[model samples]
Target: MLPLTRDQKHLVDQILAFTTDHVNETGPAVFTVYGDAGTGKSVILAHLFNQLQTAARTQPNSPLTQTTNYFLVNHPEILKVYREIAGQAPHLLKKDFQRPTTLINQLAKGQTTADVLVIDEAHLLLSQSDHYNNFYGDNQLRSLLTAAKVIILVFDETQVLRMKSYWTEERLERLLMPYPHQHVRLTHQFRMQASDALVTWINDFTHGHVHHLPKDIGTHYDLRIFNDAEQMRQTIVAKNNQVGLSRIVSTSGYPSTLDGGKHYITEGHFHLPWDQYNYTSTPWAELPQTIDEVGSIYTCQGFDLNYVGLILGPPLTLSPQDQLEVHLDRYTDVEAFKRRADITDKQELIAVKKQLILNAVNVLMKRGVQGLYIYAHDAHLRQFLGAK
Candidate 1:
């Protein structure tokens, strides 16, 4: 398991102690742990799960015995990586982990009860059900609350990637307002080994409070803006050789074709393909062959990397209003927008699409721990980013 910082350990203590007192109380209790990418929320959660198991061993009527433990993770890659990191706490490991859709299916079949549910990356929880999960409530959050006595939802709104997940701090509060809940804020960031200044720089640029901020240049963050993708690729590859993990992540404005040959993405002169998702249950960042393929938001979210080569594609462009905005016509990931067939309001529809792209850019921009290398596909964006 990941070593928790002092801040993380304190949060774990609060959660474990809180659960012990309120586990068997009359009704459901909700707690929302709020933290951004590098705050180490997942590790703290794992520790809480461990403490629950320990309590179960000593006390037969402990929360763990009465309420089943379920860790809801988003992806198979994340699940595989989490299980590996969770280590010896098998009862606290992936054995107890499941996806929300799986739980929704179980609930639909009348197979679910009030258990203790701990959700990681709760931002990815779908706010709407597709045709297959028609029986699922208005969203998974409703169903999760119904099925769990104690619900701990760990979320970061900036990490919301898709269109269907409408979870915000407000939405979560509205859901929890009916129940007594606790709010824990993770103040220390250990994921990137990143300094406060660097995170502020990222926050500033991604939030559009500033445009074209320069790298801090020789201190904590090794951020570089590249005029060329190949040069950035070479730098990331060399970094991966020196230390451990590095990746080339792009906005989904790049097109891909699986055709007959090896599947690849062709964007002008750049011919990188996507990594296969079904490969041997290994983390995408750990796989050696993944160096040749590009990663999307789904694959890279909730994972950290040493060197990140970011490719900003067609969707991101400096507008006529002299601001960065999502150009829906230039974007390749139109499938997400197309799914919202019921939306009749023009402005709301456009706003939703823009936010999705912005959130994608935000996530791609923040993945690096040691370094960030960026290459914007549009010359205007490159010029904008390269400037201080």
Candidate 2:
């Protein structure tokens, strides 16, 4: 279960008020919660959603009573966690939690409209039609707004990972221009135990700015650069054994395909299969056996870990000028950079691909709550990070 901070609790109350005001409005109403990864965005949504359901089901005097609501997440892994939590709550039903695509398709079939729809990972909602996912709508959020009275969503532009689902503040605002909307940005780093300086170091590094590692950085966080990949894996295993929820994750340079076969990440006699498509209810990071597999951005995003061993893959390298360089050809995730007709400029498309790669790096780095371990496939980059 997720716990809300004092500020998060207040935010929930504010969102509840926003929902109450917009419940009776004729057009679509939007309340967006903006925060970087680990600022307790999801926790606020959890509490707010629970309150909505409770007031709707148990309090006849409440305006929310008799309201039909739904909780949506585009990520299947996160959706599984929500549904599992719903199974234990008397006020929330498993059916109340669904993928955005699933809900959009259902509403398109002339199903009952939702009085309130709460969306998590709103950045993952498709901006363009994805026939593979069975979402042929022009835009998922637009379709949802048409089908729901009030929509509350959480978004972080840095978490936008695909060309199809790509979003920025400007893009989102342009879409919400016609709707009655309210938004707030949360700045605290709730997920990482590290100091602000450390967080800045991470942000800078992902942005291709390499600075010397801070001398006092290890005071609160266990930040380490490993010279050997196998040694790093061993250390992560030890961390998992001691405290649990630690896993080795990597960026997308290795050989990966949609084929139902295993591909291995081989580094200095250390070999592990890429994370398998999880068919079970458990999140990938929580499973004990996942330690033997190398996780990618897909399975590990939106989850927290006690320790993260991140392998900066081959696509990421150090330039002769000592800056970070991302080689697009080395990136194996073709689906992430798929061509979109709207993106006609070649340089703009290339820049977006590189930024998405950096975004993946940012996501993996922030997953560790207590510690972060690093191993780079590029020797110069590893040597630079390992420098005293």
Candidate 3:
């Protein structure tokens, strides 16, 4: 069973009730659930989905009898995690859940249909087609909503990580403007075990905003700043040895590639490799060797970690004015923005391009549940954070 907070449970109940009441209504019904990174938005959705599935199968004349659920998740890691939960021994959620690319192809070919659309991590939905141009004409969210009778989106606009698919809250709102929609808010931090004060402080810290920190910062939360990457890795290894689930995440200083040859990620005296490739059936975090591999935002996003050791790359460094700047050139995540490379002169794309990179960095910073350790590649940032 999926666990949910009081507010989350109530929101799930309301959404289910509203969805059941409008099972046969004309047009499409839309509702949104917004929450911070770890407010149990996906967990609630999972619980409600299981219940509805059970009702449709075992219960006679159930309101959900006509309701068919087609679950969509844009992020691959998150998609697999949900599938693992829904399918235990055989580990198959093939019929109910889908990846965006797969769904788009099926929808284009008229191979599938559903009465209700369930989307998790919907903020990762792509506004534009990918490099292969597989979904050139299909705006995913709009297409999914139009295909179903009712659509439910669990989203956090701040988590948008790619230039190809980054849709702002305003954009999503505009899309739903024509439909009657209800909004729900989730305001709890269940992923991180740290005190509320510490989570708030880390949020403020990542944004470059000021946050008053208590003198006893390390008492409740195991937050720390390390001067070197090696020490940071060792500390995380020790933490994992004790409690497990510790991992290291880094910015684009170490480029990731799929050339198929083993390549080690080396910086000065510190050396490690990128994670081994993982299929949809296996997650990198679940493997023991994953600790020796450095994870990027794409791999680590939307997942909880016992402790996080983040290596700040040059892209995230102090400007001459002492204000922090996110340098695009220093961010080696060109694979993510390769689709936008041809449109160099487009002003709007360039503006959001930087914001998307920063958003990825923000995700890694907020991933730790128990503690967050830091390792800065830039000398200035190293000194700056070490002072904290």
TM per candidate: 0.90, 0.98, 0.91
- Report the number of clashing residue pairs per model: 0, 0, 1
Give the candidate order by descending lDDT: 2, 3, 1
**lDDT per residue, candidate 1, 65-167, as tens digits?**
6466677876677888767755666455455677888877776788765457788989988777655544355678887777667888799887776667756
lDDT of each: 0.74, 0.90, 0.75
Model 3 Cα lDDT, one tens digit per residue, 1-388:
4567677678888998877876678758888999878788888888777766776666778887746677788878877787777676232255788887677678778897677777888888877666474776446887776677788888887688777776778888999999878888887777777677766666665565533454555454677878767878899999989889899988775666678765566657678887666764767677788989888787888888889988877777775556667677776676667465435677776667666766776788778888889877777766766534
**After superposition on all CA atoms, how large is the RMSD of candidate 2?**
1.2
Best by lDDT: 2
lDDT of 3 at 292: 90
- In candidate 1, which residue pairs clash? none
Candidate 1 ranges beyond 4 A from true positions: 61-66, 110-114, 132-135, 214-218, 257-263, 320-322, 338-344
Task: Estimate the TM-score for candidate 1.
Answer: 0.90
Candidate 3 stretches greater than 4 Å from native: 89-94, 131-133, 208-219, 339-348
- Prediction RMSDs, each to the true structure: 2.7, 1.2, 2.7
Ranking by TM-score: 2, 3, 1
Query: Native-vs-model 1 lDDT?
Result: 0.74
